[model samples]
Target: MRWMKVMMALACLGVVSACSVVTGGPLVRPGEPTGVLEIANGSSHTLTVILIADCSGMSYGLNRLPSGSTIPPGRSYRFTTSAGCWDVSAGLAYGTTIYETRFTTQVRPGRLTRHTVTGR
Candidate 1:
């Protein structure tokens, strides 16, 4: 009976630990000519985010996030872009743990444009 109790306790602990796992983050799709980026913060705290295009070194948009702004723990916010070469970065503050995604423009005639991006 003592061994059965120990196994029950272990099973309960395992279930609790599995429920505490963190999930959700930024997701970008590159196959579309124009599309939006979906960002979800699953942590217990709010996250300030700045999104920028790597080519021009300009920020496309900014958001001062509050808890439950996107969805519950598994929800998200999205940002759309026109047809162009660009990249995205999300971080806590000005420059901390920034994540990036680079994309290229669709080919066009009579307009020669090239973009080279270095990820950080």
Candidate 2:
């Protein structure tokens, strides 16, 4: 029956869909400016931004910035995204101990989260 097929499709979608429940009612809410997270790399080596969201089961995990994508030295990447988890942690992997930073507060709507990686 068509209804049966529709139900199955929705079930599959639900199994793959991931949502985040943030406190303070989400920064952006229903109608508001979306938040952005920007990262600047001043180190000599390329860097990658890895995000661990509260719950991410979608394709390629819940990474806002996928892996393999490199941010060359002296480059910056701005992620204009929204929150889908109650808590999110962002880390800058510079392929060395020279510099590293992790920000646990992330994906907040209506706000711009910024992180700069520099040599220690």
Candidate 3:
């Protein structure tokens, strides 16, 4: 009788544990959704953007660094970064000259930031 009671208790515990595990919703980091960076080229000539990003918070490591001279005019390039902060370095290519600039941004999840470059 004691062995039967222990087996019944163990089975009940297992079922309860399984239910909790199975019914738990997806795990999302605090302030989830990540961040997006968009570079819009409004300059009349074809432009290229070389983007480098350094990120921190929530997820760690791995940032996209884009290179090569061909972003095209009136086009936008969008990339996602971590949901906290990013130090972005951009190199703009116009004609045969290259100009470099660096800036930092605090990013919130699901928000889009558009940085437009136009004129001389």
TM-scores of the candidates are 0.33, 0.50, 0.52
lDDT, model 2: 0.54
Best model number under TM-score: 3
- Residue 86, model 3: Cα distance from true site in angstroms: 1.6
Question: Which segments of candidate 3 are over 4 A away from where they belong?
Answer: 1-33, 55-69
Model 1 global lDDT (CA atoms, 0 to 1)? 0.43
Query: Which pairs clash in model 1?
Result: none
Number of backbone collisions per candidate: 0, 3, 0
Please write out the lDDT profile of model 3 over residues 14-118, one tens digit for every residue.
Answer: 997564344321123355677777767766655554443334322222223344445567887777655666655455676688765556666677898777766
Name the weakest run of 10 consecutive residues (lDDT summed) in model 1.
20-29
Error of 2 at 65 (Å): 3.9
Model 1 lDDT per residue over 72-99, tens place: 3334555554344544444432245544
If the candidates were sorted by their lDDT against the true structure, best first, what order would they fall in?
3, 2, 1
Q: Could you give candidate 2's per-residue lDDT for residues 1-120 as a string of tens digits?
A: 999999999987765443332221222336544677667776677665444333432222345555568677788777655554423333445446434454455556666676666645
Error of 2 at 19 (Å): 10
Q: Quick one: best lDDT, which candidate?
A: 3
